[model samples]
Structure formats: C-alpha cells, structure tokens
Target: MQGTSYYIPAAAMAAALAFKVPSLVRAWRDPLLRAVCALLAMAGLVFFFAAPPTIAKVNRLTGVTNFSAPLVYALLSGFSASCLVLLVNWRGGPAERTRRISRRWIAGYGVHIVLLVVLFALGDTPVERLRDLDTYYANTPYIREMIVLYLTGVTVAGMTMNFLCWRWALQVHGWLRTGLLIIMLGYTFNTAYGAAKFAAVFARWAGKDWDALSTDLAPILASLGAQISAVGFCLPLVCQRLADTWHIWASYRQLGPLWRELDKIAPAHVRAVGNLWWSSAELSLTRRESDIHDGLLSLHPYFDHDVHARALAAAVAAGTDPEQAQAMADAAMVVSAVRARVADPEGKLLKSSDTAESATAEGTRDLVRISAVLREAPVAAAASGHAAMPESEVH
Candidate 1:
C-alpha cells in the first residue's frame, strides 16, 4: 500500500496525455463531447493519485503486510468520467433509437458501479485463506465484511448492466454496450471471489477447524476479471468510434457547399407556369432543367453514382407508370444539388424567379426548396414511368 502505489499516478497521467490532450482540440468542435472526454481523462488522472491512500487504508484494516487491493477505484473513477462525456451527448427528438440505447447503457452501468462503490465503502476484502500474515495483520474482520457487502452489491448491479447492454446490442451493430457489460463482469466475478473469501474469513473467525477460504483467491480473480471485462468494453467502443469517424469523413468529401450545389441546378427546375399549351421548345427547356438538376445532384458529397443509377432503374421498374419514379429521381437530384450548393461558400450563386416570390434573394436557401423537391427521387417515383422504374426507385 505504501511503497509505489502513489507514484503510479505520475505514470497514469503520462499515459493519459495522448487521450486527454487531443480531446482539447476536439472539444472545440463539439463542446459537449470534448468536455466530457477531457473531464473524464482528468478524473482518470485523479483516480491514480487517490489509489495509494485508499489502498493504504485497506491495508491498515486488513493487517495484511503484502496485501493488494484490486484496481477498482482507479477504473471506476476513469469510467465514471467517461460516462459523463457519453451521457451528455445522448441524442434527442422523435427518432430516439440511439438515445434509448445510450440510456439503457448508462442506467445499467450506473447501478452496478454504485453498488460496487457501496461495497468498497463497507470495507470488502477478497482474502479466503489466512497465513500467519492474516493473524499478524488482523485483516480478516473488515475484509470479510466488505466481501459480503460487495457480493450483494454486484449481484444486483451486474444483472442490471448486463440487461441494458443486451438491449443496446440488439439496436446497433456497435459494442458500446458490450464494453460496459464486460466491465460489469469484472465486478461480478470480483464480487464472487470476495464472497468465497468472505466464507473463508468467517470460518477462520469462528475457529471451528473448518478449512476457511483464503485471501489469495480474491485478488487473482478480481484482477483477471477486471482486466478482461475492461478490455472487452473499451476495445469495442474505440473501434466503433473509429468507424463512425471514418464514415463522416467519407461523406463530407462529396457534399460540398449545399447552396452552391443548389444554385448550379437552380436554373434547370421547370417553372410551374399556369399555361399548359407551351411551345415544344418551351417543354424541352423544362426537360433540360430537370436533367441539369439531376446532374447537379451527382455533385453532392454524400451522393454516389449508384443512387442515381438506382433512381433511373426505378423509372424503368415503374413500367408504363413512370411519372412517379422519374419525378422523384429528378427531385432528389435537385435537393442534393441544392445541399451541395449551400455547402459551398465561394460559388455564392443566387436564386431568382420571374414571380413575386423570386423578387429578392432573401433566405436564398429557401427560394426553390418546395419546387425542387417536387422534381426529385423518392417522391418522384410515380412520375418516372415503368420502363425507367429500376433506375428511379430507391434501393
């Protein structure tokens, strides 16, 4: 408890530098996420520092000379900090799928962690067997008491967290919940070992000649349990984050400025003139506008060539009734084009109309929003006709 436990904080901080420092830069992008991650990192730093004193107290209570306390305090401190980051960023609104997943995870982990802490506060220990050292240290009573507390706490906590983790797994293909469960497992087995040790400690105190459990079993089980669980949870969370970040990056590349993209395709949108008897050339112009809008959509950062082809295919699939599909495809292109245009700053193109609504470029983004939508993908599927259904229908 005394020699080098306190010094480990320095090492912990050094290790945390990579994780905590860059979070400062990231915090600026999303104040909530960065703040949470950074704060947690700092908490992790504090955790290592607090370890020595806490462990020293345990050593005093157990009276075991070469005694060890599982690194639960350090882990819990860091994990709680991380939860702050994750909890703050939970999603909102009607499509509550992601938020629900996170909530389940949070609730599960929170319950288990609280129980674990309470058990520790009650002075749990893992020692099952007494050596001469146990007699000398007088570690049995308090340690045994803690074991009983921990077992009760973990039984409740682990089950709750595990269920939440299971729910999250069902919703998404990520391991955020998995990671949490793994860590919870650490508490589970650690508690089990402590429970076993509790029986041992109790038997020894009774002095009935029954073979009591020993302290040796508790620490080994706790350490291995914690390590495996923590790694199980952390590895997946890290991997999931990496994958999500990569997807965002890839999507950002093609989108460009949404306004600029819109402007590029703006002129192509057919003006909904009241008169139906327009000249053939006029009708052709409307068609040209539709084509340009569709082309502009291809410029969108997130748009892939496959989407365009699929829209075209839908038109064919619609058979003789292609209007819906074609119109939808065209409208989708217009919308994508508009988004790309808006995303661009340098183009700064404007939208104007020959009507009263087109007078000034105010709220420029809204100029043809409704009309453009009428000309594009999902919605226009009915307009594209059956021959082109395959290309126009959304996959």
Candidate 2:
C-alpha cells in the first residue's frame, strides 16, 4: 500500500512535467511555466525519495542507516516551497509586485528549510524506520521537533494554496474557475493530511496509540491530494486545446458545401495540398476560403446583375431582414454565375464594371455568415439546384 501510494504521486508529477516541457522549451522566460515545472519536478523527487524501496537503497548506498529520512524531509520541504511559489506566480500581478511577492515567499520558506536541516541534525535516530519514520520517532528528542517543523511548513503552504485557489475560483469563469476549484479541493485534502500527521505525533507525545493516522491514513490523503492537484493544474490547458480543435473541425465541416461548389467551377484555384481530410482544419479552412474567392473571380464574366436583382426581390418578399436578404441575393447571383460559366465557358465575358457591388462586397464579409446562408437559406437550395444541373442544360 505504501509503495503504491508513493508511486501514484510520483507518476502524477512525472506526467505534469511531461505536459509542461514543450511549453518550457518554447518560452523558457515564462516564469509561471518555469515555476510549475519546478514544482512538479521537486514533487516527483520527494515521492521518489519517500518510497520505501528507494529509501532503503539510498540508506545502503550511503552506508548510513536511515540517512534517507533527512534527505526525504529536505526534498519535501523543497516541494512545499516550490508549490507555494507556483501559486504566487499563477496569481500574477504587476511584474515588480510579482517578483517581490515571490522573493518574500522564498525567503520565508528558506528559513523553514534551514530549521528542518538543523533539527534533523540534532535528532539521533540510528535505527532504520523508512515506512514508519514519523511514528517511530514521534517521541524522540529533536526528531520530534523536525517532524513538527516539516508538518507545520506543509500545513501552512497547503492552507495558503487552498485560500488562493478558492478566492481565484470565484472570480474566474469556465475551465479556469473549475480548475481552481479542483485545486482548492486538493489542498483541502493536503491540509487534512497535515492535520492527521500532527494528530498522530501529538498522540505519541501524549502516550497514546494513534500511529495508524500517520503510518497509513495521512499518506493516502497526501497521495490523493498530489494527484488531484496535478490534474487541476493541467485541466485548463488541456481543455482549451480541445476546444480549439473542436472549433477548427466545426468550421471546416460547416464551410464544406460552399467550398465544394466553388471547387467544381475553379479546380485550378485549389491548392495542391495532399489528403485534405487529414490536414489541419484551420489550414483547410484558409485554403477553402481562398479557393472560393478565386472561383468567384473566375466566374466574374458570368455575373448577371438581373439574377441578383430578382433574388433580392424574392428574399425581401420571403420576410428576411434587408441585411440577410442581401446575403441570400448575393448567394443566388453566385449560383447564376456558376450556371452561366458552365453553359457558355467561352462566351463573351462580362465587364467587371457591370457586376453588382454586392457581388464584390460579399468577398469581404464573414465567411461564417456566408456559409450559414449557403447551408440554411431557401435561395441556397435554389442555387444548389442550378449548380447541380448537367453542363449542357445549365443555361
């Protein structure tokens, strides 16, 4: 159980580090990313040192019985310091203020770390007690002080994180708010873990047997808290990336009918990109929009002003607002232009001056609105029918 608990947090930290590395590589100057990465790395180290098998191996390799205790304590203190700094960096303010705040935290935690080392040195625990180190040394001289100091530091950091996360959660929205809430909940577990350890240690001092709280229960809470907090840190970034991909895919799919109709008239305008289905939706949308513009340009000669005038009258009669009616009319004109081009590919080309201003203006409007019209408007169906006709009968 101990090994499994230790490994779980170790794995969570490793995953967090993996998730942050690419961003760190791209922008090493980003202080928040650096702080987060450092926090995860230190956390992984703490769990690695705390695991029983690894602790035993360190003791054997160093030839100092129970030497891993001080090492693990130091690493835990470092992890606490890193975590506190990360929260500070996350809740950013003015540059100088953030820096000053970070420095103050570092200095304060530095004192706790120094005290941890000093108290560990003053303690005399020659027996190896890896799994039950806290309970075993609960009544020992300076070992008790070291344990209390470490727990105090951890408890303070955890409570501070909980307060910051909860306060921030209430002010934010969407995934960020949810992530902060989860982080707040994780820190609640962390504070409870600290309380459990303090209780068991105090029980020992009082000559009672509440060793299970420290030996078993606290570790479980710590492991759960670590894993949950790691996930909370990552959730917003992951959700944002997923949302962007979904938007891109939706745009690509929604723009398909218009793009396909335009492609038929001006295949030459299509970029020579391969396997468009597998290409990025953003890139495909860009290329598709470009192709539609080029297709409209090619059909400029076939742009009949009468077709646009008739479509506008039909749309207004159908009760669409003027702005939307204009879009539908423009859509109908494009359909007529496509049919004219198919019917008479080599006929006399219409002069650019003869085209309605709306036909040219359509190129500059939002493609989404145009796509919506193409997919949903009544004139769009009429346009599609004309576009689908056999080339010989298109006229």
Candidate 3:
C-alpha cells in the first residue's frame, strides 16, 4: 500500500500532463512548467537507458551510488526554483535584478546536487547484509544515506511550493484557484512522508537501528501520504475540466436572457462583429440569435454610461491597432475616474486570452459591445432604467 502511494503523485503528474497541459499553457503561461515537464521526460530516458547500470551497481551494495539519484530530488528542485522565480517576479520592481535571482536559483540547486553526488560516493554500503531492500542497500551505503537526505529536500521544496500555491489561490477569486490550492495542499502532505522516509534512513546511519522504521510503520505513513498526494495531483486537472464544463453551461444558460435583452432595439450590438466569432475553436457564435451569449459578457465590462461612450468613441476613432484605440479611451476614462475596462501592461485595454491575436480581438469586441448598447439615445436610456422611446417614435 505504501509502495502504491508513492506512485499516486506520479500518476497525478501524468494526468496533468495529459489533461491540464492545454489549459495550463493557456492560463498560467509559465515557461517553468513547460521546462519542468521537459526535464521529466529527459530524466525518464536516462533512468531507463543510461542509469540502469548505476542502479544495478547500487543495488549490489547497501551504502551509496549514482548521479541519477537526483531524479526525485529534481522534482523538488524544479518546484523550489519555480516558486522563487514567481516570488521574485512578484516582488521585484521594474529596476530589480532579474538575472541575479535566476542565477542564484540555478547555482543553489546545482550545489545541492553536487554535494549529494559526492556524499553518495563515500557512504558505507551494506549490500551483502541489506538483502531484499537490505540487499539493495548492501551494495551502496551511499544510496541508503542519500535516500533520507533526498526525501528531506523533497519535503522542503514540496512545503514551499504548496504554500506558494495557497497564497496564489487567495489572490484569484474562482473555482480554478480553489481547486489548484487543494491539489497543492494534498501534494505537500504526501511529500512529507517521502521526506520522513529519508529522515528515517538518515537516523539509521547515525545509529544502526533500521527496524525502528520498517515496512509496518513506514508503509502506513507512506500510504496516507500517497493518498493525499494522489488526490492532490489528479484533482486540479479534473476540477479544471469540470469547471470549464460548468462555465460553458452557465454561459449558455444566460443566453436566453441576453438574447431577450439585446433583441429590444438593434441587432447592431448583436451583429457589430459580423465575421468574428465568440469562440472560433469550440463554439462558433456568428448569429445575433445563435450561440453568441458567451461572447456578450465582454460588453459587461463597459456597461456604465461614461464607459459605454468612451469605448464606443474608441471604436469610432479608426486606428490601425484596435488595442491602441481601446487603450486610448481606457486611458481617458482612467484619468476621469471612470470605472471600466482593465488595461494591460502596454497601457492597452486587454483581456486574459490565450493568444495575442485573441487578446486584441477581445479588447475590440468589448468596446464593440459597448458600442451596441449606446449607438442610440434610446438604448442608453434603457440601460440606465429610463423609459426607452423607440427610434421610429422619436423620429
């Protein structure tokens, strides 16, 4: 059961690669995550092909062995490094030393890995006496000693990563954030076991009492740890998928009301972007009365009178870059203390989109929707709870 538990995180990690990769790429856009996965892939190749001989050698004795031992350590190392990067990025001003933080992280993990290798070479292996696991340990005393050390590292990094995730969850308000934090918590708890197992090994080295931390005590602890980790690993991806489904469902649910509301005066607001879709990939929404409700929410960002006017004015200004046009209006409104349309780093109005092209499109579409709402005086009046006079009646 304990052995099985260790694989839980491995499986969860695998599932995330399979299911959450696309979303992760889309949402987080963290290069470190991609690098981590790539490193895992490379390490797997080495483990199966090159490291077998080293593993065999270590298997022969119960003391120590191999540069390959860093594989598990690598998980924590990458995590620790990534967390530090995020922290640095979060705290650093525009003038802060960006390269310095990165260099420090690399140098730190590298030193740790080197010391571990040297320590592995010089440990007292009990290969002959350590049969079964005892036999494996017998050939490489260094391996035995390092096991506890490596696990401790895992624990330290895991704790740090999980805490970082928890804090991040606090910043973002949504189900996705909650799900990810839960997963992080789970992994942290499980990693503690892996860490403890390593600690136990170290204790044995300090004193020759191996039986004190046996399959009985260790396995149960390991098993419980695995359970937490396994759930943590798998759940974020699962919940993310589930959350997406619910989001789409909720969007569609609001479609009927949106359609009824927009249908009142002009389909101009509805048909402003005649060619563009709400979602070009999954749900193609082109019609005023079709699957377009999902796209309409972008207009919500500019529902207020001043926001609606500025956004529409931005659209009418006729610039080569629609994003720049939105930014122009967004800036004007910000100074006037008008609340609407979030600006991106470039001082352009933007949305959180997967693609650069889409980000601009979202910005343009937002203002367009606002354009729809305020094209005529009656429409603006309706939005503000005034008795809306029909365009023909006014004429």
Q: RMSD in Å for candidate 1, one decimal?
A: 14.3
- Reference-based TM-score of each model: 0.41, 0.84, 0.47
The Cα error of candidate 2 at residue 76, in Å, is 2.4
Off by over 4 Å in 1: 1-18, 21-160, 163-174, 206-215, 249-395
Q: Is candidate 1 or candidate 2 better by lDDT?
A: 2
What is the per-residue lDDT of model 2 for residues 1-395, given as tens digits with 9 covering 90 to 100? 56776777788779868987999999999989889898989989988888998999999998878888878877877887788788888888898888888888888878888887788778898899878888889988888898888898889889888888888888889998888888888888899999999999888889998989988898888887887887788798789889998988788777776666666566443435523677776787677667777677667666655667777787788898998877766677677677767676554444323654333444555556556778875658865443343444434
Best by lDDT: 2
**Model 3 worst lDDT window (10 residues):** 335-344
Better of 1 and 3 by lDDT: 3
Please state the error at residue 386 of candidate 3 in Å.
14
lDDT (10s digit) by residue, model 1, range 262-353:
44544443334312444443354444444434444333333333444565576567562454444444444444434444454344332321
Best by TM-score: 2
Stretches off by above 4 angstroms in model 3 are 1-12, 19-103, 123-148, 162-184, 187-191, 202-253, 257-395
lDDT of each: 0.44, 0.78, 0.45
Deviating ranges (above 4 Å) for candidate 2: 91-93, 268-275, 296-310, 343-359, 382-395
Separate clash counts for every candidate = 94, 0, 30
lDDT of 3 by residue, 279-315 (tens): 5322532243342333333323323335435554644
Best-to-worst ranking by lDDT = 2, 3, 1
